[model samples]
Target: MTTVTEAVPPAPAKHRDQVATSLPPARGQSFLKLVTLELRKSVDTRSGRVLIAAILLLAVAAVGWQLTHLPRGTINFDGFLAAATSGPVMILPVIGVMAMTSEWTQRTALTTFTLSPRRIRVQLAKFVSAIVLGAVVTTGVVVLALAGTALGGATSGRATSYAGMGGEIAAGYLTVALNVVMAAAFGAVIAQTAVAILVFYIAPTAWRLAGPELFKDNANWLDVFGALGRIAERDLHGMLPETLTAIGVWIVLPTLVGLWASSRREVK
Candidate 1:
């Protein structure tokens, strides 16, 4: 029997499924790293670079316009800075909108959300990046304004008056932050680039024109643009509460909505 029977091969060992030994450390990583990534995104793309160039060009044009058109007596540092900043202020918020909406518009949300599952931090990083970029743009415009001021002063024989300029410069930075971040919040809530920009511009402009007619004085509290105007004028002394209220209504509320919208939006 032993000679006739072939020894059966040992039964193959049953395969067992192995469990994952460890999980990845929660969703969080480095926030600074996230901001750095966002800053790269803002400046790295062709469109982004084009927009930056356009902003600088428009700023230079503004300075040049003032140099050519304005009376020499009025071509002081303050007026030049104000003129130079105007074009950028209008354009800067577009960058904010792009910062918040570009991922959605370009269909990169899936990867972004996948890599950084906590979406709020991602939104915040983009917002911070927009602010930083706005600051850089502002600095550039300030330099142009200064150069123009020097030229204007030399040609016109008017001393570069810095009477209240220190205050105005500080106020200008505040206005830029408020507008850019507010636009970013709007973009985050909408998650669409074109529509967000349209609304961000139209809504405030419409209110600025009509709300004063309809709501009388109460529009001050709801008018972010008006508050920003007051801030730009460095005239918030008597109306700090109302100015803050407007900022709260426009900036803080929209920012909260944007964070929530971004976090919960489907990542398809």
Candidate 2:
């Protein structure tokens, strides 16, 4: 009789388990990296580039016009800062809205959600990018204001007080940043660029116009425009409560709603 061949041995169950478990740890994108990507995306489009250029042009024109029209001694740093920032502040919110709505408007939501999966991170990245943009614009305003101030002083031989102007300027820029964020939140919730922009501008204006008649005793706390006006005036100490309430309503509430909508919306 022929001898039977030896049977082959199987791998140990523990060894199999070890092989299955041996995978590289999962790596996700960092917040800073996401912010950088978002910032690049904001300006990569043609519309974004045009908006930025237009903002710069408008800022320069505003400053130039003020210098030409206002009396030489009157063109102080504070006034110059306000004039320089007005154009950017008015339009920067539109940029924020575009950033938030571009994914849906451009039909890239599918790819974006697929790559990131967690939508909150994407929204947060957009928010951070908006803040960064606001800061950049604020810096530009500051530089322009300084230059204008120096020129006015040289031309008119007058010196203006720089005492409390710093705090006021900072508060004004911070309010602008907050407004950009609020617009982005609205954009995220609506997911439509035109609708979001319309609502962002119209709602505040309507509220400001009707708030006193409608809300009466509570307009100060309920009206975003009034609260932010106080903020722009640097009345932080006196109006802190009202400011917080307004921010909670306008920025915080919309942001929460946006996060909810973004998380649940189907990606097609």
Candidate 3:
């Protein structure tokens, strides 16, 4: 009995650090945190910084150009807002394109996807960040335009109109924001910065130019720019169906395709 009583040793317990490392993190990545990271990444690069600086400078230049060229009587808050918004709206889509495409172009997709395996969440963060950037740029443009309007009015003794301008400006902001988001979707689908940017600008312009000749009476329904134009003119109520159709074709379809592609595409 004594010879058979050999004691067994206890297994060594894993240290707390080893246990922690063995498991996934206790907290999952947060939406707000992802959005914040995306936003920061948007402008952290040299090109990103340049694009941002160019946007601000262009907005200022546009306001100044309008002041010098337009008659003082013609310079109003609404007009200023429109002109200032044009600068950023023209270029913000490129920023959107770069935002999504850079993940692959810069070879960071592997790291990004690895950290967050749910690619849709990453896509959503990029989309939300683009919207946030659009909103901020729009607000800045509006502020600058307001300052310009005040200066012009004070110096020239011209009357400024505040009535019925809010809706128009808001519509412009929304249209611009939608356009940016659409470009981001295009980038997500295309996965190439230059190609996405080119298609985003040229394809729309070409369609607008050729649609009337090619599609005849139905072109407007399929025209992305046309839908956006209706929005810019504050004619959403009148053209709601056509606008929705255009969005379905241009935005919704591409977004769905992009999400599908992103989900299955191998992360290199």
Candidate 4:
């Protein structure tokens, strides 16, 4: 007699397929999270605290000194903005460098890269955060400086127009924002905060003091710092093309290189 064999059940192949098809990290859990996380990390550290305090102090001092020492005339609040921005400009690159280099210096690069998987995203997040931070700080300072100048001018019976200062102050902030981006790019390219700071600090001073005789002919196009100084004058004066090009070179190129490098390098 032939015995009927029980039918064997088939495995759930569709369930396996569905598991395979499931997407990676949700769309909401991307770049912005990484940036916010990074910013938080930065704010929690002593170094970060010191750096921020220094920047604020410098801003306050620069404005205070200018208001007190500026030759009595129109009480140029715009001019004070220009002076105040100089401090932030000098520090912007250093801040960028610190943001990038700190990952390595603080031994967080490995964790950051591993979690993100896309190293470039991490680098870009740092960059965007730095730019935003710089712009916020610079703009806030400009507003404060204007208010302080207005109060002093009003009490002293001096001629200071907040309306007139608006354009110049805006230009000063724009300059600071641009420089912040450029500095972050440089830090990314260099992968070292110290070097980026040195380069950022020295390049402008050196160029102004020892530039070639033809410097005047090409200064409008080649000098990043000079562009800021010129722009602070608030006329544009046909310098936008040159300023844009210089920004691309000094900031964009380096940032791209750094992103590529960060993507390729082995996290430590």
Candidate 5:
């Protein structure tokens, strides 16, 4: 007897058992993910690789260059460090610009902000990550600097006081960190990397120049890099208050403005 057979429909998958889980990611986790991705890209890329190498190579090269220009007996370790480090400071800001600009150029920020929807969180992550990256790079520079010093046949230690060292390292890292934060913030404000980079390049110079000339003594309060230099040197040059003000303007103002802009802008 040919019996009619009933077709059975497939059962619905359990929530936990679904091959593709439907659980939403935690909010903070998404921000962390963004930071990790940025750092990873930086570490993996040829350009990022070149950054550290270039710093080291430049330090050594500066020592070589100094040998040619400096008097025979003037080739001291401290002098070598000053010469090597001076040129590299300009490069750090460029790095800050690149960090933010690359995101838009590569379209990575779209995916990043889309996932979290909390722009501040993403900004904070980038800021923190940039500080860490800068610290690591600076540490590498310091190592290379020490090596260069040793190669120069000098045995004296760092000239700055312990207190000075503390302040110097803190200020140096903070300066680089603030630059990164400014870039990230500016990126959000402008949304175009090219425009942001141009502003970053010009804004501080204008501020420093116009500040001192226009404001007189008040200019020291407004001079961004000059204040940073004082803080880094721990010179107790009565610029501490001004340096604090500059830090507030650079680090906090840009961050607030950026976050506001990011919150308002349409996600492209």
Candidate 6:
């Protein structure tokens, strides 16, 4: 009987350790919290702070420009608002550019992506943060305009007309949002502060100057400022398609590229 018996395998263990269990899903940072963090990061650094201050200073400088150039009683808020935003509009997008590029140049992408493994969410948060900064700067421009309006009125002993310009305000915000978003998109694509800034400024200017030669009136399709300027004038009744086309090319296209680039961008 012993010779006939064969060794049998041990029965399968039924230990609880072998049980397949679902883990509570790993928690992630909230999108709004991500946006808030990005927003803070936008202004937390020394250079960022300086750039923001420079934006407001430019607004004040616009006020001075109005005070000196415009005759008394003609110091309308509409004009002040327009003048206040002109220089800042050019400078404001730089904030968006820096907000994105600084993270790369300063070597903080490692920390940023480590905390938020979903790179797209982080990139998007930064994008939204730049738009939010544009809004904040726009509000500052309004406040400076109102103050300048009062000062101009008092100093000139002239009546100030707000013009109750709703269209202009709306157009201003749209223009600003577009510019900042475009700037951020360029930074995302280029991933360098200086190059992004130069390209963002130069490419548009170059295109504006040279495109007319190559494409004629049709060149306006690729003219970012020309399209945006028309929109800013509240002249979208007939040019909406043209404006959208330009935006699609400059903003939507680059944004897609930037998101793709940022998602794959290597972090050191």
Q: What are the lDDT scores of the predictions, listed in order?
A: 0.88, 0.84, 0.84, 0.72, 0.65, 0.88
Clashes of each: 0, 0, 0, 0, 0, 0
- Candidate 5 residue-wise lDDT, 133-240, digit = tens: 776776666555556555554433323212233445566666666666666666656767678878877888898878767888887776778866775565748667
lDDT of 3 at 161: 66
Models 1 onward score TM values of: 0.86, 0.87, 0.89, 0.79, 0.77, 0.88
Q: Over the stretch 1-268, how does candidate 4's per-residue lDDT look in tens digits?
A: 9999999887689977888789574564467898888788767889877877788788888877776775667776666676676676676556667777788766788887767777777888888777667776677677767766776687678888555765665676667767777777767766667776787678766765665455866665666666666666776578789877666766677778888877776676
Error (Å) of candidate 2 at residue 253 is 0.2
* Cα-based lDDT at residue 242, candidate 5: 82
**Against the true structure, candidate 2 has what lDDT?**
0.84
Q: Ten residues in a row with the worst lDDT in model 5?
A: 155-164
TM-score of 5: 0.77
How does model 6 fare in lDDT?
0.88
Which digits, one per residue and each the tens of the lDDT, describe model 2 over residues 44-158?
9999889888887888888887677666444467777778888888898887898889999999999988888878998899888988886786777778777777777676677
Tens-digit lDDT string for candidate 3 (1-268)? 4577668865456666676789976799999999999999998999988987888888899899877766745456777787887778889888789888899899999999999988999998998898888788777878888888888777677787666678877897788788988999899999999999988889878988999998897888888988888888877757788899999989888888888887888788
Clashing pairs in 6: none
Model 3, runs deviating above 4 Å: 1-25, 70-75
The candidate scoring highest on lDDT is: 6
Q: What is the lDDT for 144 in model 5?
A: 59
Per-residue lDDT of model 1, residues 1-268, tens digit only: 3568678886544422222325444555799999999999999999899999999999899999988876745556788887888778899888899999999999999999889888889999999999999998888888998899889887777767767778888888889998999999999999999999999999888988898899998888788877889988877768888899989988999999999989889988
Task: Looking at model 1, report the run of 10 residues with the lowest lDDT sum.
Answer: 12-21
- The TM-score obtained by model 6 is 0.88
Q: Show the colliding residue pairs in model 4.
A: none
Over 4 Å off in model 2, which ranges?
1-26, 72-75
**Candidate achieving higher lDDT, 2 or 5:** 2
- Candidate 6 residues lying further than 4 Å off, grouped into runs, are 1-26
For residue 185, what is the lDDT in candidate 1? 93
What count of clashes does model 1 give?
A: 0
Note the residue pairs that clash in candidate 5: none
